[model samples]
Target: MKNLVLTFLLTVITVGSVAAQEINWVTLEEALELQKKEPKKIMIDMYTVWCGPCKMLDKNTFQNKEVAAYVNENFYAVKFNAEGNDVVSFQGKEFTNPSYDPAKASRRNSSHQLSRYFQVNAYPTIVYLDENADLIAPIKGYQTPTQIELYLKMFANNDYKTLTTQDAFNEYYLAFKPEFKG
Candidate 1:
């Protein structure tokens, strides 16, 4: 009976840990739809299956507890496959990867039109959009949770609006401290 109880408790703990690590990633359309009812900034993780750094960002940054909690609470997170065939309609236009091949889905296929629209020329770019679905910034590269925490907080608190010059951004970046452990 004690062994059975121990096993049950371990199972429960494992399930809870898994749930805590999972980020609530929504489709781009779903995020836009939700924005209509309740406004929130949108964060899109543009990645390709073939990119190693992209996978690292998923396993390290997105899975971080503090990053997951903050993003889920303050933004509508969207995971977009840059080379996928999914048709995305945004702002008044339709975007698709017309040349995307299913066989090449696991490899480097054609990029979606939306990626071109956002000018995302690299993998693992984190695109930030304002509450109205307007582009705020496209930060390219693999960022650790500690590295991304600055942008997340800056945008969430409307600090980016006041950063009109490079000097201002440098000042803010230098003065800011990160608290996220993961």
Candidate 2:
């Protein structure tokens, strides 16, 4: 029947949409293992379920094929929920959300200690780390697809190590594209 065919089509579309939204994320431990085997930088997307900008970044920036491909190729990308209950061990320390309250979901429980360890002050914070698991500064707030591309290229090419100051980075960034507004 026509109704049956329409229902099937809608189901398929819903499934496809959900699949597209799903990110291929690895845990911190898995990323560390990969880093140990090969020298690749790490990009941690520190997000919370209730954050709007974080959802936008996932739907827009991270979903972009170019951004996803570059991240997959150059770094061990880990999507970490700030309020998650799982145990995260980093730098010989175990980080966990010890005060999680399922009943009061509105107030997203305390962020894991790892969130503080990385100094994430806002939602949708992206923490970039070097090959040795050293902090390369946490890029706070939401970033557009193009903006993320710039950082990915800068860190991927090891430009961050050479540029000591923001002014120097801006100079180099401008030289690359003088008309760039951001």
Candidate 2: what lDDT?
0.84
**Top model number, TM-score:** 1
RMSD of each: 2.1, 4.4
Candidate 2: residue 22 Cα off by (Å): 8.0
lDDT of 1 at 71: 96
lDDT of each: 0.94, 0.84
Model 2, residue 97: what's the lDDT? 79
Worst 10 residues of 2 by lDDT: 173-182
Stretches of candidate 2 above 4 Å error? Answer: 1-23, 105-107, 177-182
Assess the local accuracy of residue 38 in candidate 2 as a C-alpha lDDT between 0 and 100.
Answer: 96
| RMSD (Cα, Å) of model 1 | 2.1
